[model samples]
Target: MSPVEEVLDFLIVGAGISGIGMAVHLTRDCPGKRYAILDRRDQLGGTWDLFRYPGIRSDSDMHTLGFSFAPWKHEKSIADAPAILEYLNSITDEYGLRPNMRFGLKVVSADWDSAAARWTVVTEDKDGKQGRVLTRFLFLGAGYYDYDEPYDANFPGRKDFKGQVIHPQFWPDNLDYQGKKVVVIGSGATAVTIVPAMAKSGAGHVTMLQRTPTWMVSRPAKDRFANTLRKFLPEKVAYAITRAKNIFLQDLTFKRARSAPDKVKDFLEKQLKEHLGPQYNAADFTPPYNPWEQRLCLVPDADFFEAIKAGQASIVTDHIEKFDKTGIQLKSGQHLDADIIVTATGLKLAMAGKIAVAVDGAPVDFSQHYYYRNCMFSNVPNLISVFGYVNASWTLRVDIVGEFVTRLVKQLDAIHAQVAIPVLAKEDEPEAEDIFADFSSGYFQRSKHILPRNAPSLPWRINQEYRKDRLDMRQAPLDDGILQFRRVRETVDA
Candidate 1:
């Protein structure tokens, strides 16, 4: 057994964007605080590092997605995956964050001991060696996306397929598909990206398989107004304006679309029918669900449409019956010949995987947990977690979370407090009418019971209105709770 180490003030799990963002604020805002960040992976940039599929780019506009303090200096607002990864790496390097980071260390469990006023943390290193450490606070920066394995859809006769079968999340690097026919399954961003990329790379034919059509919109990689502003004014000023504009427009459109469905349907129908042509009616491409039910797809340069127009790619609106030796057999009795199949199914989220936190020695299952301000679990002490939206940039929420924590911690310290936890009752009880987050994903579904069901208020809810979030985040009360204060002498054993 590795010897027990000195207790940490703050112990962060996951060294990805969430982890880095939180740590930066903690270190900078609170001086002389001993904090450590642990990550299972060897490198940083969690999702960005894991996914290496072709033609990957930001679905949300970059201005809203990037860190508010660190304005994105890139000419193109819609950055590719590699570029985003590089940006994350640069932040780590610039901040000298490598020293506090323990790579290849995975936390097995964390139990909160109320009597001792500390958390007992168990971690396994890369070599399966165990180590123990006590920490005052636990901040979960582990993202909502599941990293274990891809969600593989089981079609009949999948084993009989002779060609290469790849999931966009796990594409084999060595395999080349220069002159092969490719069939991409699912209609999400990954599938949309793969089709255009494969077609351009000399794939004889690329087919996009979708069970239902999603709302896809085309926008420039770099907006002219944003570009001009960035060039002339300061990056922060330009970013502020761009972020505000996108947030307002998205909220406005989504609100109008939800309230008045007919207008949205008609507008979207006319746009899709114009591009897809008369053969396939607008109803075929239009979704059965309401607009913004899921995040609308954003395409740069209208590449998906261009690929279809060029006859290199075709859309198959049929449920997959089974996979044959050469290709897939559709439910409509049509079999398309293919040398490769790519499943671009959505992600699976795991909340605080393996890190079990207990209150007063009783195991605390955070699944189906309540989210106070969408950051803290109800009645949970010295712990808070942040998850961003599917619509706007993740960094936007993460930054706000970091700022709030730092300010709250400082406020606690000022009052000679040992523990600082949120008080749900003190902060107005959330009404059923205020529950705002709308995600049908399995992760959200599994844990929604415990999460704060608010209809979307100011800081606690995801308003996506930049002006509102900015005001709330920058000017909200950091200490609204009855923070339990413990004197060191009271806990000391004789």
Candidate 2:
């Protein structure tokens, strides 16, 4: 170890919503601790800054998506990318966190030293310059998806027809699609968002081509209740009430979908009928899986349906045979001629932000280890990875995780402990289950092997229920028997 190297009390990865939220907690609760935030991108907003695709907006309401410490005062609950980014920027300004942020730095790997009770983190810059940071605690808020690559469907004969093939992840700037035919592949949120955007923005015609149907629900862009409350109450109070109401509705809907799928399906069908009217096709809208099995795509203000009704956008369900010079040829003997093709297939999931992790020179395989408290992994000391809920807003989990991590840090100081780890005894090891088995999304299914093990019960599993997790993480004892704390004396060389 270099004598001049500075060791931080906390080193947070990723400058996205999760990382920003974590930073807020550290500033408020552990004010005396030294910490910094780093991200691979040049900008702070992770997903919001990366993708420049049109009609990009939050699927969940801003009341739930915004940080707990901040109040989203915008009229639109389902805000566009710019509004969300502005909100994040405001938080940084209000909390004075900008000085501690380091951009264009990617975490390459992290190795924990038991003797020092600190993590030596390796990082790389945009120019391939290597750097290292020492931190007593490592917090990973980099998110769960692969930032460099999106899931590739690898359509046959891609080089032959291509006018301009694009993935939503890497959207080309100022690409002209006006008065030209556009075909967007996949039926997920990206595709749904892009189809209406392109069609309404001046594409001669847009068609959503999908192999399978995805469950979709539409609500107004603005929240009337939230807006009314804001007029009469303080901004923070109104935000709190709005956030609580949305949380309850979200949880209730998810529970209803699980308990009575048929009823949920019928309700969705009714909503679709109201939105699409004469253009509604039962076969096209109906999905094979139950509602909430995969995330239900949110269509704000029925824009997608409006585009369809106006003869600007359409949906085609079929298998792709291959791509021709003009467009895609469907297995059903139909050809889609297009000037632009958008592949909104899906994202590729990753673990630990693709950072190679090791403990005492032994590499850590996250799949073999069990998740403890949905934040830390078994036997991993002084490290916490923030993974959000699939059914609810991602920020909901972020808030609870931030609170829990802050409390844990304070507890370590109170006990004068150098390291804290969750250790599972051989006799107490629970049956291993797929962490995201309940969600049948393609991304989750594709990356199951790389994820950590989850059990059926709490403290050993990653729970999706935000309400229960919030209570347990905030109220639960940090000195539980499973989590062993130790004091280590630093060894100095003579």
Candidate 3:
């Protein structure tokens, strides 16, 4: 039997970091607002729940990645997947957010009614059952990547390869890879992580084969300053101090890389040479592109390098001509023999799970519209979708966004406003460019076509700076002239 429809003040999508973070804010800041969260996955932690490959961890430090309101008390800033998931669960338990979450519900479509000033959402479950939800506001936290479909790259001769092929997105839970030769293709964060992880997992040989090199660097796993501060000062004070320092350092590094790519690149290579020593190949870490052009792969505590030094794993730079019966054959006439191949290539990006949208029964094409305030869409009422920073910690922007959303919701309620929509002036040009214009990552480039148009200035530009977005999203006025507020009358049958 279909479940009875229930109405809410807000309907949050996905149970990931963004969804959980936003829900906590709404509970504390907007007590009067009622909401429900729906996630397609069966678990509470979205990314952490989905990715179960060995040695999975955050690329950014937890000080910034963790929630702003609730501090991460762990000594390790670079935490493993399990620890991060535990922390998420702990927060959910603390705030009683688990019960409000509905698992195995994939959102299909959401229709906004001008007459009713509410959203009617359609969702389907794992058992092929359908459900409906009504909400005044729709918050999309489903993330950008599609969980069901990883980026499918048809590398030549994939079908004829004798060895088993695996993609990190759909890792087999029980596939025994122990004492077998493994080749992980790709040089991104995923490849770097799995190469060392698989090597430690009893793989006789683990080779990371890449066509091009990606910049990689390492940092200590634990934060001594943050740990010491926690012992003496209050939790909040210590967390704030730690978070601020990390943010400042990260921003300065990125800025310097952008401003002086040659100098930064030389320094990075020097540090890498010191770690790898003597046999260190500069060509393996050095790329044709400048630093900050793509995200620098982070190896915590030099784990990847240690694995290499210990003769557990290796990196090979070459273009793959095809997958042969034995292994991958490179264009340079070199062949890598492997018992298993792991394609950690990349992900397929989709916004809000590509849910069909309509405003008063008229289909809304995201490409035709412009993003307002980096979160809301132009002419889209009571809707906010989070697209975090590429250069800094994702949750930093997420934290600011969560606060902004609840504040906006509260202000609407204060004025008895039924619908709050952002309206871009006709004079405003839809620049048709990305908010992160200079990011040259393959994943970002691949999704550009499907991304929505964006404007270029304040309150609209998707600024990547943590310091600027911190104040802009948190301290900015809610009643900007751009947002049109109204109390639409509900239709009554005579």
Candidate 4:
């Protein structure tokens, strides 16, 4: 084993919401533990910092999205990237977590040593300088999508286009599109956001061209109930109440969509009619799939519909034949001329932040293992990866997982166990199921082979139900029969 300066109790990768939340939990629950947060980016805010396209905002309400320990006092529940980043920064400063953060470091690989019961994590900085850190536990909060690459749809003859072709993931700051025709490809959240934003922000006309329509709903930017409650109650008290309310509503809506998709579809149709009125194009708005199959796009204040009604934006549903010199050629023989093309095509999902993981010199294939309680994997010792809920606010799962991790670490110390692993016997292995079977998102579907296998039941599966997961993860036995605990020989004194 290589000599290290100091061993960290927890080495958290990615200083995003998940990583920050975990650090805050460690500070409060595992106060004696030594931890450090490492992020590839120089700045903290993960998704919020990475994405800089116009109209970039939280699809989920801030009441639930914000950290449970921190109250989101913003007037708008659906906030932009700047506001979200500010909230995250405040949390970092308030918790005194800045000193423990190491930015501009990308984790390359992690190898666990059974005898030592520690992981040797390899990291590389921007200048290609390598560094190593020895940690007892490794937590991955690096998010699911690939940071270096966006999904490539590979539209034919993209090179032929003369106009500015851009992907929302990498938007250029100097590019000007005022009084110019804009075409946004894809019907996802990014596309919806860019269409309205470009339209409202001086684009002569903005057209959203999608191969297939996506489900969308509109609501007010600010939460009336939450804003009202803040006036009478304390900030934390109001946040808690609002958080609970939003979680319940989110769960209920998901359940209803799955149980009675037809009714939910009708409700969405009604909303579209109300928002777009005469401008409503059923063929362009109505999706062939059921609600919640893919994420339901949330448009704050009907801005998207208003843009279309105001003649600044339009929707074109057709397959792209190819890209031409001036614009895109559609299969319907329609040519949409554009000075700017924004490809909002979805992200490319990457598991474990594409970090090479090995256990005892053997490569670990995540697909072969079962997800143990959504936080840890089967047969993987001293590792926790936070993959949030698809249907609810991501931070809802983050808060519960944070609580569970703190509890697990405490139990390990109490039992004098140096290593804890979820061991699944060959015969006892449950039937394999897609972790995100319910979700039909392109990214989720594409990454099925790389993701860890899920089971039909609890503890072996990644439960989407936050209410159940919160209870199970928090109160469930730490020394469950599946998880094996052992004490390794002490190599160094703390």
lDDT per residue as tens, model 4, 262-282: 999999999999998998889
After superposition, the stretches of candidate 3 with alpha carbons farther than 4 Å from their true spots are 1-4, 425-427, 491-494
The superposed Cα distance between candidate 4 and the true structure at residue 81, in angstroms, equals 0.6
Error of 4 at 410 (Å): 0.5
lDDT of 3 by residue, 312-423 (tens): 9998999999998999999999999999999999999987678998898888888667777778888888888988888888898778888888888888878988788988
- In order, what lDDT does every prediction score? 0.75, 0.92, 0.86, 0.92
**Candidates by TM-score, descending order:** 4, 2, 3, 1
In model 4, the Cα lDDT at residue 149 comes to 97
Per-residue CA lDDT of model 2 for 365-419, tens digit only, reads 9998889998999989989998898999999988998999989988989999878
TM-score of each: 0.90, 0.98, 0.97, 0.98
Q: Cα lDDT for residue 18, model 2?
A: 92
- Compared to the true structure, candidate 1 yields what TM-score? 0.90
Against the correct fold, how does model 4 do in TM-score? 0.98
Off by over 4 Å in 1: 273-284, 423-437, 440-470, 481-494
